[model samples]
Target: MPETLLVLLAGLAAGALNAVGGGGTFVALPALVAAGQSPVTANASSTIALVPGAVAGAWVYRRELAPVGPASTKSLTAVSVLGGGLGAALVLALPSESFDAAVPWLLAFATVLFAFGGRLSGALRGTLDRPLAPGPRTVLVMQFVLAVYGGYFGGGVGIMMLAVWSVGLGIDSATGNPMRIAQLAAIYVSATALFLAISDARSSPLVLTTMVAGAVAGGFGGAHLARRLPARLLRAVVLSTAVTMTVLYFLRG
Candidate 1:
């Protein structure tokens, strides 16, 4: 019961964080790990569990979605889907022992990316007075790579997407927000589909179902609250969570 409750709360916070910014994986992945799942299974399960929330967030921003530079929304989404599938396959192919050893370092890397993503985006944006105007190919390639990472271990994938768009396409975070959510949904959707088909995410049906329900509710509510809540407050809360979770994972290791 306690484990169930913990995951339920984690799902709520993870969904809210994803809706407000992009740190859902940081919350969901660790929670599943703590629930006694192996790192590989936890990662796959977390990805599956968070799919609904990302989709809900995407729906909320549907009308506002924009293309990344020269890439149309359809094109970007297609690349994200393909890349996500590949990443999921990679995860399933890895041995459990290898994945377990890598989890802590992955969490630390994600924490750093989440912590500095904004400032790094700003710095890169400042270097160019105008958007880099990378051709459609370059934009798609960058997105594909990020999508691969998103599928494999999503922790700060959203922030990385925003940063890439800001640097390569001269898109500001606000302007790119809708696209970020959309692409995240695309990646998660593809990844989850793959997970459900071949992974053991279904092993903990109760935990997964509870988290999904909470994520959906939280994602919807968070989308509405996003407009009212201060962005700094949201970012601070997520960063703290990410830091704490990363530390715990390292200690466990």
Candidate 2:
């Protein structure tokens, strides 16, 4: 009962965070691990569980979605879908030992990105003589790379997307947020389809269902709350959660 409750709460929090900014994986993955799932299974299950929430969040922001620099929405989504599927295949192909060892490091890397992504984007923007406006091809390629990573271990990928757009296309967080949510939905949609078809994520059916329900509710509520809440507060909440989870994962390792 307690384990189920933990996952439910975690999913709710994670979905809300993703809707507001990103970093849902930081919450969902560790909670599933603590619920006695193996690292690889937990990762896959987390991805599966977060899909509905991400889609819900994306739907909320559909009206605000925009092209990423020169890349049209359709083109960017295509690359994200393709890259996400490939990354999911890689995860399924790798041995479990590698995934177990990689979890802590991935969490740490994501925490660092969450902490410094804004600063890094600003620094890059300031250092450059002009906005780094790459062609559609270049933007699509970079997005594909990020999408692959997102499929594998999506912790701070949304922030990375914002950073790329901010520096390369001069898009601010406010302007880029809707598209970030949309791309994240695309990545997760592809990954979830793959995971459901072949992964062990379905082993914990009760837990998965519980988390999915909570995530769906949270995603919708969070989207509404995001309009009223302050962005700084949202970022602070996400950063603190990311830091805490990273520290715990490192200690566990």
lDDT of each: 0.80, 0.81
Per-residue lDDT, model 2, residue 66, is 82
Report the C-alpha displacement of residue 40, candidate 2, in angstroms.
1.3
**Stretches > 4 Å off in candidate 2:** 96-128, 231-249
- TM-score per prediction, in order, is 0.83, 0.86
Model 2, range 66-138, lDDT digits (tens) per residue? 8888889999999999888888888888765666567667666666765676677667767885556699999
lDDT assessment of candidate 2: 0.81
Q: List the residue pairs that clash in candidate 2.
A: none
lDDT of 1 by residue, 19-101 (tens): 87777887888789888887788888888888898889888888888878888889999999999988898888875566656
